[model samples]
Target: MPLLEAHGLIKSFGGLRATDTVDLAVEPGTVHALIGPNGAGKSTLVNLLSGRILPDAGRIVLQGQDISKAPAYRRVQMGIAYTFQITSVFPNMTIEANVELAAMARHKARDAMAQAVDHALETVGLSDRRQQLAGDLAYGHQRLLEIALGIVQKPSLLILDEPTQGLGDAEVQWFVDLLKSLRSETTLLLIEHNMDVVMAVADTITVLQFGRVLASGDPESIQSNAAVQSAYLGG
Candidate 1:
């Protein structure tokens, strides 16, 4: 069974249906990309999966347990972590402090928390900058720090929303490399606009349009799909 599954998810904001019976399955140890044009409900789906917003109707099953009505904090404790499109780091805090805070939230033992913080910083290549204020680092480094916060707890599933949004070509490449290294360690659900990055990294791709799923398949299949081409790739 897939590690996470969304069954017939439906969320409406008044007359606008932000999610229309969306179904998604995320397999363990794979990268699943959710891609579409703006207003296609990708963000809404992410929110639903992270429990930031409760689904109007449907069920979310993680590890065979229904979590549709779970709160955001509960979801995190259930091994789900999310990194926002916008960097969500404490700018005034030192890099190590930011990671330490995330570690503290996940681990009660002081030694375990310290070890987690150290691993997170080293994994994100920020160990050298541990003592620097987050605001003082380059934008790319700050973004990595945000990712560190998400991964410090070793979540079973990691949801990244537009992780490369503000990155330049070099930084995007770096982020891609980092993501590739993480695939074996955690399941990834990525909501991304950069088609190149998505195509490069995603094992499966799901396309959405007008709050509904248009197509879902492997990268090659999704690339060749006529509906996906017209709806998202502007073919």
Candidate 2:
């Protein structure tokens, strides 16, 4: 069975239907990229999947259990980790503390939590700055810290929204490498605007347009899809 599945999800915002009867499945141990133009309801769809918002109709199943109505924190505890499009680290907290909080949410033993925090920080290349205040970090590092927070949860599915939004080329490359490394350990659901990164790591690509799935396929097929090319890929 798919690790995560959303069947006929529908979310409307007054006059606009943000998402319309969308069906999506994410397999285990693979990177699934969600891409589209800015107002394509990508954010709304993600919000629903993460349980930050409720879908007007439809159900979300993860590992055979229904989670459509679960709260965001509940989803996090149920192996869903999310890193936002914008950094949301606690400025007053130390970097290690930020990650520790995530680990604590899953009820890890003290020792285990420390180990998870350490590993997550190390994985995100933030080990050396573990004691630094989060607000003191550069924007790129802040983004990395956000990623560390998500990884500390050790989720079955990690959703990253615009992970490389504001970074230099070098930082973007680092993120690419990190994404590749992460794929081996956990399934990734990425909403990224960077086509290069999307093409590089995504095992499956799904394109949305006006709240509907326009195309979904392997990278080569998505690249060649006439609808996808004209819609968001700038044909």
Candidate 1: list runs displaced more than 4 Å: none
**Which residue pairs clash in candidate 2?**
none
What TM-score, over all chains together, does every model reach? 0.98, 0.98
The clash count of every prediction, one per candidate, is: 0, 0
Q: Which ten residues in a row have the lowest lDDT in candidate 1?
A: 100-109
Tens-digit lDDT string for candidate 2 (1-235): 9999999999999989899899999999999999999999898998999998999999999999999989999999999998888677999999988998878877558888888898899999999999999999999899999899899988999999999997999999999999999997799999999999999999999999999999888999999999998998888
Per-residue lDDT for 1-235 in model 1, tens only? Answer: 9999999999999999999999999999999999999999999999999998999999999999999999988888889999887778998999999898887656778888888888888888999999999999998898899889988988999999999988899999988998998898899999989989998899999999999999999999999999988877989
Model 2: lowest-lDDT 10 consecutive positions:
100-109
C-alpha lDDT of candidate 1 relative to the true structure? 0.92
Regions more than 4 Å wrong, model 2: none
TM-score of 2: 0.98
